[model samples]
Target: MSNQTEYAYKYIRERILDGTFKPTQKLIESQLSEMISVSRNTVKKALLKLERENLVSIENNKGATIKSFTLEEVKNYLEIREALEGIIARSAAQHIKDTEIDELEQLLLRMEHCMKQNQIDEYSKLNRLFHNILYNASRNIQATEMVSMIKTQLMRFHFRTLLIPGRNESSLNEHKMIFASLKNHDAAMAELAIKQHISNVRKTIENNYQYLL
Candidate 1:
């Protein structure tokens, strides 16, 4: 990505994550440029890209704003995520080698360790690695692409939900079972395990009822 793109993605994504910017708040081009010390053109281009990815909405006459979703939309996104992720895990089992499997195991261990240490930052980074590896393993562009979109839309909910009390341990155990299924080459088990993981995520997000649609 270009420096402008990187700047915009990081700036906007973090604001969205931290709630510094509300969903309906306008993302003025000049304001972003001044805030990030980038040029107006760069901000405009970045907003365009985000819009293309469905992460934001730009009105030709009214400027851009963070995309707001309904509660049902969030649930629907998770339902789609569950189906796609399960399929990805199942397909990955056929192609994943032992070395790659070991690498994934190490990630689960790291995630477990991070939880014990309360290393939220490292945990989130490693979590990304786990999912990225799965996406690559699936070897299906369409499926991975859909998951990427689902993840992008759901990123805000992850921190609010996953980092909640008692959720980390639950996630760690779920990952272990999924890893075991993958290690054993049991496609059915792997699929079921992944679905369970995602279903729990849906629950976590749902439990945060104060979080609007």
Candidate 2:
């Protein structure tokens, strides 16, 4: 891809993930081209790439629109995430560096502070960073890529989960358990802890999906 196309891709994808572009919202190539200072053809290429990532849809008559998911699709993605994250946690326990573990510990401290201060957005950012560190430590590029792609598609719903009442405290506790298991280099416990964390998030979404909509 050219630099222009890459920029257009990141530009559109970020808006979609951050909810600036609502689901099913039409993506006009000419407008995006003007905004990103790229050609309409370049915007089209970027939209195609995003479609492959499941973040956009293009049809014969329709140009492009942000992809929307059904509740079942969301649940399916979360279930896949739970299994993949468990693998990541297990591998991270075995291969993670001391410095990486220390970073996770410090991040957990910050997350706790965020919870106490009721900084949901800040906590959510930290939560992504926390998992990213684990992803890097896991040394499994394939699984990491797959997890990230799925995450990009579900980013909006994931943030909504954090907005649910009492979810921050529960999420923080879950992260602590995951941190403890990784710090101890206990692969099985790490896997279990992370799986449980994702499972709880899935259940929370299932029970309180209205907030997401």
Candidate 3:
């Protein structure tokens, strides 16, 4: 892709992932082009790329709109994440470096502080970084890419999971367990801990579907 198209793609994709461009919101090429200072064709190309990523939809008559998911679809995505994230944790336990473990420890400390201060957004950012370190340590490129893609699709819902009452504490505890397992190089325990974490997240979302939606 040309630089202009790439720029437009990142601009639009960031807005979508960050919830600025909400689900099912229309994407007008001309408006986006003006906003991003890109040509309409560039915006169109960018939208097409996002559509391929399942972040947008384009139809015969309609130009483009942010993609929306049904509850079942969200659940299905979480199930897939649970499986793949478990594999990642297992691999990370075996392959993670000492420095990576230290980094995770620091992130966990920061996360705890965030929880105490009621800084959910900052905690969420740190949480993503924590998993990203594990993803790199796992040395499983294919699974990492798949999980990352699915994560982008579910980014909006993922952040809201922390908003549920008492979830922040529970999530921090789950991460501590996973971190301990990885620090000990216990692959089985690491996998179990991460799977349980994702399972709890799924259950929380299911029980509080109305709040999440």
Write the residue-wise lDDT of candidate 3 on 26-133 in tens digits.
999999989999899999999999999999999977899999988888889999999999989989999999999999999999999999999999999999999999
lDDT of 2 by residue, 8-90 (tens): 99999999988898998999988999999999999999999999998999997789989989889999999998999988999
lDDT of 1 by residue, 40-156 (tens): 888888888788877789988999999887778888999999999999999887777888898999999899899999988788788889878777777677998989888888777
lDDT (0 to 1) per candidate: 0.83, 0.92, 0.93
Supply candidate 3's per-residue lDDT for 117: 100
TM-scores for all candidates: the values are: 0.91, 0.95, 0.96
Question: How much does candidate 3 score in TM-score?
Answer: 0.96
- Say which prediction, candidate 1 or candidate 3, comes out ahead on TM-score: 3
